[model samples]
Target: MLKTIMLALAAWFAMAGGGGLAQAKGLAPLAPVAPVAACADLARIDLSGATGAPTRQEAKSVTEAGAKPYCQVSGTIAPAIRFEVRLPLDGWTQRYLQTGCGGLCGNLRIDAGKAEGCAPVTDGSIVLASTDMGHQGMDTAWGNDPQKRRDFAERGVHVTALAAKALIKAFYGRDPRYSYFSGCSDGGREALIEAQRYPQDFDGIAAGAPALNFTIQNSFHHGWLAKVNTGADGKPVLLAADMAPLHKAALAACDGNDGLVDGQITDPRTCRVDPAVTLCKGAYQPGKCLTAAKVEAARLIYQGARTAQGQPLEVGPLQPGSEMNWIGVFVPMNADGPIMSGMFASDTINHLLFTPNPATPYTPQTFPFTLDMVAQEQPARALYNADNPDLSGFAGRGGKLILWHGWGDPHISPINTIAYFDKVGEAMGAPTRDGFVRMFLFPGMGHCSGGDGPSEFPLLQGLMAWVESGEAPAVMVAHRAKPTHEGAPLPADGPMKPPPGATGMPKLPMMPMMPPQPTLPPRSRPVFAYPAVAHYKGTGSIDEAASFEARP
Candidate 1:
């Protein structure tokens, strides 16, 4: 109790005055406490409280190829919230990091996403924990159970944090100096829900492409994409081959709009792509042109979900530049199997989004895409959606939040993330929001990482700097092995020379031939804070991060 009170006081001072101001307030920094018990003894530690009791299954030493040596403790919170806690054997930094899970999230994943440059993670100086969100599989079958659903919604993370902290204290004899949460995609949803529902759980949070506005996104947005691509005969209107041409066309129209012809639309919102560009003047040619049906399908998808009266049902449509990602997701690769959006929409509607009514399993085709459908989502939204912008509790405690989304995200539209950020500014007041909250939209990046853009950035490192030192990130440098999507490796032996009679231009310059410039494997670029994008300075190589500057 004394220790808890002392830690709370320290946190309060830290929040109130940051570093030097806390000293001016006459408060000394809290000293670290050494381990009071053995690692294995944590198995018997009591974590019972208002939430419930935890059942320990295993507590032992763990050492993997890439990971540092640590004590791996496995346990379950009340009603089967399976969790794992990793305590560093040495170089403990008095910090706790909890990672969120992706998709249905039934398996434990201890990875902190995009942790480059984060000292605690890179140096293996922090305690880490993760959970399966109370279930055992990557499906929505467990949603039928009310307690499990509740656990998956919010309780699981909170309980896991509590258990991890209790175990941390038992082994280290004191609470961590700071706690942080990081996640992307559905895990991003989990991160936001944690901040909204349980503010004190972490001092800093980094949510990437978070699935906020859950009920509408899962039902209306995902469902609309699936249903729109299906023809009257229940066949896919657009195939994988059909999607390439549209993306190619979109690129041709807007790739250079940002003053750089770098195969990526920096801000897709400003780019308007007309589907007619890909429309077949005559009969359809697979990768060159699209038939009217396919063109209409692409147009409708970019137009987004709408009611019969034409009112928009979603935050916004998938941006113009993201059309290529629709191949395996919105459009089908073949004539038959389910697309990605259909699978997710079906799972959500049939099991998780609505109260379990196993008798009536809903699919994209079966679910009604209307305002009534939106109204019916209130119950699930209360538990699932983290759209509430009132993050006063979190901000009040000096918690720092970093919300990032890929501008070219195919699954969840970046517009949704922008909408939420706008709401936060409105709810908390722009000044207050600016103090603790920051949003970064990575151009050409997909859901979490992979896309045409340089999605890899130091998210954890930036969040830590903000939380620990009050240093807000003005811009983040991102990188990719191959700078642009146009990069395709040549033959291993050597660059292929075209036949002498070939009509097309050669890969190398025909006149004034000189050695080709060395291709830099990893290309670095900058992504600025929200509403600001990286603009090329025109004189320097666009591939280099230093050549670009942040502009609103």
Candidate 2:
């Protein structure tokens, strides 16, 4: 039944693509092509001028029930970069897709992030590939070796694209008519790198929640949060139980700013509610009001990293509506160990961020939050930072870039993405920037997907429409998963809990569930391009996308 539904969706999508906005504008639809080389022959083909002696490990036809047949090729780029490429044996679109990797990528994953609704991917009709970013483990120790560091920084993604396209040509007997890249988080950083450094690699790029300012993000921002939340006893000053009330207060103050009290703040930059307002008046109230120390800690975190002169060190601070997701990062589950933020900061500072590794590793509490510390990251900045805004070459070649970020993202503040977008406009006149780049902010969404607002959207579909037919996306509908139990939303507390034998807090249900049953269609809302917001239309159900329209 599921297969039948997917097949039906695929057919419908193909028909829709045939009559897309491009067709309405009298543009021709891209035609599908056929492969010329046998699957096994891919292993013998050589990639000229490609480094790491690109060697194909296996090339075989993959067959599955109710899905299109495709050639799956796994290979290694010299010195340990692993990648996988999949090419459809039939109904091949004259297009190629390359996916980005997340956080210290050590495994090859070919997901099309934010493009799950794209029929070509759902039906295995497009050529797709992804690399492990030239490393084998999540540990930053690989950065100690200059070659591996270069691979993890920028070389990996670039070389992988070159090799994948070569293989695609070998298998199809022709280069793709168009190519696209999509990624979120660290992958998002790679997408920007491609546009900035290797403009001709892809025709369109989709980046979400990008770790663009790598040096500051992994060091200063994360370290600051870790330091502020840790007490002298080395334990988290803010407890997991504290998140619920804090989040509740934040919503009460700012969730209705967009003229609709729908449990999400449309733009977090507009949220100015201070967490200090929830401080206890006299005696501390558990799970209700914050203590003085906790209040101060939360204040520092929300203000972000700062210099002695009170200047902002990072792009932006933690957002207001993202309070619930801070439990694991700012508040730890264990009593003694470092929190998630500390681990990320320490790994980068000790192994990768600086040129000569620190003799004595800086703990989150010990890392100096000073101008000198910021200067210390310079050696590795060129390799890791993708903050470059100049994309003249890419834009000159008609490359389209889509940037999206979740307004409620607890990791890598969405404000940074906005600032970067604004910088792009400043660098290349707003009119020119608008012609090739578009950014979308998803309200109520977490770092990547889950949150109170709709998160899922047809990002690739929108990108393809823009790149292939010159139709820029104005608004895209994003869907929220059905609540496990309709009308009873899931609790907002993150996955952080006190250790056994701890007291004073009730044991919260990790995941609330209900007996499986048929359910109504998911709620959806329209997400507009930046500077435009969705306004409630005052008509149909607020849960439906049709009930909202984009307002500039």
Candidate 3:
């Protein structure tokens, strides 16, 4: 069946090594077997009190960072998980299977003797990462035992997809043919809980800005600041200078709906700004408008959750580059030191909101997380809620997904990932989901990569050139600037300036995805895919990515 889903997605294009071998263009190999037929003779994959080793690295910007190229291997698989296993030994062949989150998401530790400041483009491709799923310690009691929370959710996705296919067959002693997975915000909800509980693993999967109903987004950030962060003098009422004046009033009423104004809005669903447009059509304007308890806390942080008569809840989607912080950003707004930090606030408020343990850590919990505490954490939240739209186990083993999100993502809600990708095209129908799937969004971005459109392309080399060569992905380009960041915006101090490439960001031209409006909108009557931006009725040049039309 299509060469065993391109040898199970060339093992996640060895974890997006070197812009997946230059925006993929290979595919055709498959028949390679014996990846892990039930741990074939188990030689050694131990974990008893797992400690050091697994985080190994060697030489050069983890070798010219086409995007995610870093190298390493050999296991300590357990010496108590320390971290390391980035691949790509040859020219361009990244192999990845990473993991993180021990102190609010971040794993950029890159060492094997320093210097992987990113630059190896043979159209880069070689990736694999692992922080051992649940670690980076201080305390999360090594991922709250329940058999290490079902081995960090379903045997940490088939032991990092069978230990990066046994370290790419101990470095090309054989194996790799295709594979992919990415992250953003618990790594975009662990890339939709690894394509909804391992749909035959990966051929393609990218989930940026995904918080995936993680117990309804970290209990709606501790229940929306325990209800619009206090005060009629109660204190805590929205700080960080009230999120820079509501992100500068949502970029001054959605900056010209996308035709460019710079600050970015692109589309929070038809840029509808009515905080009553920061109101003032009459009196009672206390402290410069927005009151009625600050427009009911900006309408419960923009129409999310509701009940008790005010109805409407279940929400997601505020697209058009959903900006949620850019530089040195680590927002918490409060509930106790950066949202309690880790097994996501000690396994959602001490074992899924019942809160008990370590001899009464601040009691207050009669209880209510509910659907019976999600059926007692459905085998670790169904191995990370690939919220089941059933990809018939990765499309009856033909697999090829590639989902990517951003559209200004402030931690999750790229319209709950295009409404769970229109319920995965209504449970895989339409040409069997056009031979699998595709969902890029990007636009003036945020989490899992920056913003202001054009996001420097690579996507595990376009999902490993569509898992070895059926060549699926059509559009991918991406890039942004402003970098020069190394402590010097201080006239309060001023004078340092050395990082936007020490000197780089300049690769402009490849944008491709937002045509729609200006008459006959909604995806602008046919453009289908690949590095988009159509219209060449002839007379040449729209700056060409090999001359436009990656689609209709």
Candidate 4:
């Protein structure tokens, strides 16, 4: 009895003495602890073989909820990779999140883990980390160095994950209970790489609009679009204004296919409007109708790239509602004489794929796109492509994967993701595949975000529920943000931002700036897994997600 009383007194003293035992063990304190170490002190941390030199580390406070304090650490990983990690001062959820970078990944922006209405740092409790995917810039010049190219292809993310986990352990005195990876586009590719190459890295992964078929997607697919749209003078046959009539004709034919003329095409595969219908019967008036050349361009875009024998080249057709955004891919820029996709494809092909030697590099103008060239590039394709169908290792270890794609994506074709999902299903068998993977297709959404359909949804929450609770997601509820004029301007006066990254980037030329439509209320819907479609029940308001049912 005396010994028990003494032990009770000791516990009481520890709690009253400002977390005596907890502080020593690096555990959560009984009371809020002051900043343990200066942000700059993080630079002094030894990562064994990995070198980290801090660029900046500071105590920052966010204005969400109760003004949470955090340490924002920015540094360079060994060689040239840049990384950033955010550690919450209080309310650490014992979870770690690593966000992926997009488009050549030259910047060191960390994505806020926002999905399914939960923000990890602000709304929830999770550590966040991001990296610049080795080297810098939106250009492929980094590909000149073989080591840097390999790092960007795979190593950078793995190193960042390991480094961030070490830092989190040091800060909290305990390793995270779970680790997650979230990204779209190029980041999506990173997510798949983590699953296929480093299956032990993340417990859950959310990949949206992944450019898995890296080589052919940027080279052959973009090349076909450029070649088919270019005139004999090497200029674009179609202009931005020329797209309205085509969009209108397409909407008139297919918008009501889903029992609603709501300006969004629910299923583009069934939409078949003849491009020749847009051809002008009389002399062409600019913007009134398309010429023969323009009509041919539209047909080729909708049909997608093909071999001389009419074999589909796995590139997706441009959806009917995607007309407005084609300027970036189909229209020529005055300065470069090529569209955005053309530029990306040219750099990828000449600099990365077919670099005979750095001193004597090939140019897009001189590169040939024959079947022989495609066959010759197989080795490079194998190196860059993330289309590996094997996910048994990840699934066997109980890792959960959630994939999403916008049906009307103007950049990477939705077909590519669909093809990959199908391939995974085939390799793992339908039952086993369904056990670990789920893919959601947004009807009118474009690229990573935004479209006529409800684009904003919480994928992270769904993933968490699946991973933690073992409750597989059947449908994800999505919301369409208020139109631009209702809330803010189209470009919103900020730098281009990733889904949860700081500062918004410029919208692509083909990305439409949706105007205010007071007539239509803000809409919500349910995006279902593959083999399931959200069907209206004909009872509640069409704008409410509750009005739909996920039916297989």
Overall lDDT per candidate, in order of appearance: 0.76, 0.77, 0.45, 0.70
Judge candidate 1 at residue 403 and give its lDDT: 94
Compare candidates 1 and 3 on TM-score and give the better one.
Answer: 1
Model 2 over residues 140-174: C-alpha lDDT tens digits?
A: 78878988888888888888888888887787788
Error of 2 at 131 (Å): 0.5
- Residue 523 in model 1: shift from native, Å? 2.1
lDDT of 3 by residue, 295-414 (tens): 555545566544445543345624433423411222233322232212233435554332233344321122233445445545544544446666777767776776666566544567
RMSD of each: 11.3, 8.2, 20.8, 10.9
List residue ranges in candidate 2 displaced over 4 A: 1-28, 51-56, 281-285, 333-338, 482-522
Model 4 over residues 301-417: C-alpha lDDT tens digits? Answer: 888767777777655766787775464445642323446566766777867775463355544334555677778778777777788989989998999999998886777788888
> What TM-score fits each model?
0.86, 0.87, 0.33, 0.84
Ranking by TM-score: 2, 1, 4, 3
Question: 208, model 2: CA deviation in Å?
Answer: 0.4
lDDT of 1 by residue, 1-552 (tens): 223323433464467564211111221133434567777887777677624774554688777677778888888777788888889877677889999876666666576768876767876778998888888754568988988888888888888998889888878978899899998877888889988989999999998888887788888998999988989998888887786789888899899898889878988877889998899999889878999988898888999999879999999999977765565566666677456687778888888877646477787878887889888888999988889899999998999999998877778898988899889998878888888888888877776875667878888877887787766665678886342222321110111233353222134311111112235456678776766677887777777886875565
In model 2, what are the clashing residue pairs, if there are any? 52-78
Best by lDDT: 2
Give the total clashing residue pairs for model 2: 1
Model 1 global lDDT (CA atoms, 0 to 1): 0.76
Residue-pair clashes per candidate, as listed? 0, 1, 87, 12
Q: Which residue pairs show collisions in model 1?
A: none
